[model samples]
Target: MIKLIAIDLDDTLIAPDGHLPEENVTALAQAQEAGVQVVIATARGYAGTKRFHDQLGLTTPLIVSSGSNVIEGRSGEVLRRRFLPLPFAREVVAFAQAHQIALRVYVGNEVWNNLDYDPSNGRQRTVEKQVEQMAEALVEAPFQIFVKGNRESELILAQFGEAGEGYCCRHHVYSDGISELNILHPKSTKHDALAGLCAALDVPQEQVMALGDSKNDLGMIAWAGFGVAMSWASEAVRAAADWVVPADAQRLTSDPDAEVAEAVLRHVLHVAKDKKSS
Candidate 1:
């Protein structure tokens, strides 16, 4: 029987507007009632994603910072942490400067920006504004803002790739349809974090399932026993997923993002139940 469900937040569990739908919440509660562990794995940092956890009523561990850190979801206690070295961090900063890209740096839940000029990297520039908006929301919401960037992310990724995943490097496009730095420790990833959680929970990888809708989720999707992709996910994500969940029919939601997620969640939960019965 499946013992764990590692879900991605942004486009997987939560709707695009950053709220969990009623159907999705009901599904989670049912999963819990059925004795399945529901966990969150996302690129969001502890301070950034904690509110969602509370809203979802998750009692399990969280894989945050794209697996850079693992912590208790309800209590907000750190279980494990991996961070990039200062030298490597500086290299990433230098590379962004050299490439004329704006960057947002994340260091242990603190977000810093060195944008002398506004961001100028095509779609990434749009992401910069989303980052700013998220930061602004945090100020009023009493949460942490890890970092925001308005620099060339390609340059940042070039450096991160050079440094390799060994430094816990990750790069993902932000919500505004632009790329941003989603860097983390080399060993820190949803895959590694799930493995760690599995070990702690005495569950094997073959018994774990994962659901997601983004490129950053590829690792966990690949790691899961069943990797279910959302219907509205990017082609790249869909191509990698083991199965695809259809969109929901009930269109109570008006937001496009939330609607897509609700559809996926509704379908994926059905899939999960089918798996258990099978």
Candidate 2:
């Protein structure tokens, strides 16, 4: 009965080396051929995730930036967007400055940063503009804010205790082991974005399958009726899922990132093929 599949990108659909495993890619294509709409939901921003959308040749709306933004894949048009209030954005900038760490601010299609580090995933960013004044640089509300450090997220949460009341303050680590803090509007969750897509497509909550392996994917995993958690996922995430799919054994596939493909093939393709013949 599933009509839509929401798969997280980095760990759920592709490997950590950023490789899109052939089996995973092929499974997605087969699902689409069954008349299912597939969406890539990720903590990655639009710029970071666009290439995968292009490669998949998907036309469904993409849920990006931990659900703060959703864009039409085919035309690259913003479908839904949520931005941090200007006041909060300014406060976040000030906090990062006081901590002496780099800050990356996402504003619409452009990414502004106070660091020399390239925020570009693959797309080229214009010459880095030094943000001298946090208040001035953040005149416009930002879509999201990113800060990286060794467990700096804990500090950020404690510091913003009273202020970040409703903000989605999640602490997670990058592939390289550097911990990161993601700051965004309270409503910026993949669950919220995926719900919106379901409303648009007239797909019921019980007919959606979400697969993920991390905290960022927690929202959608718990919200979807046919939720799937990677066996290697954190205890909290696995606890929230209806089913926990194992990370591939060397026999099914050696790749760790493409582990969720098993869930798709088993749950999605089997049902679709059954429906076709019946």
Measured by lDDT, the strongest candidate is 2
Model 2, 39-154: lDDT tens per residue? 99999877778889988878888999999998888777998998888887787778777766567788767777765553333124443655746666677888888876664566
- Model 2 segments beyond 4 Å from truth? 118-127, 151-154, 247-257, 271-278
Clashes of 2: 0
For all candidates in order, the CA lDDT equals: 0.64, 0.79
- TM-score, candidate number 2: 0.88
Instruction: Return the lDDT, model 1, position 225.
Output: 80
TM-score between model 1 and native: 0.73
Root-mean-square deviation per candidate? 7.5, 4.0
Residue 278 error, candidate 2, Å: 22
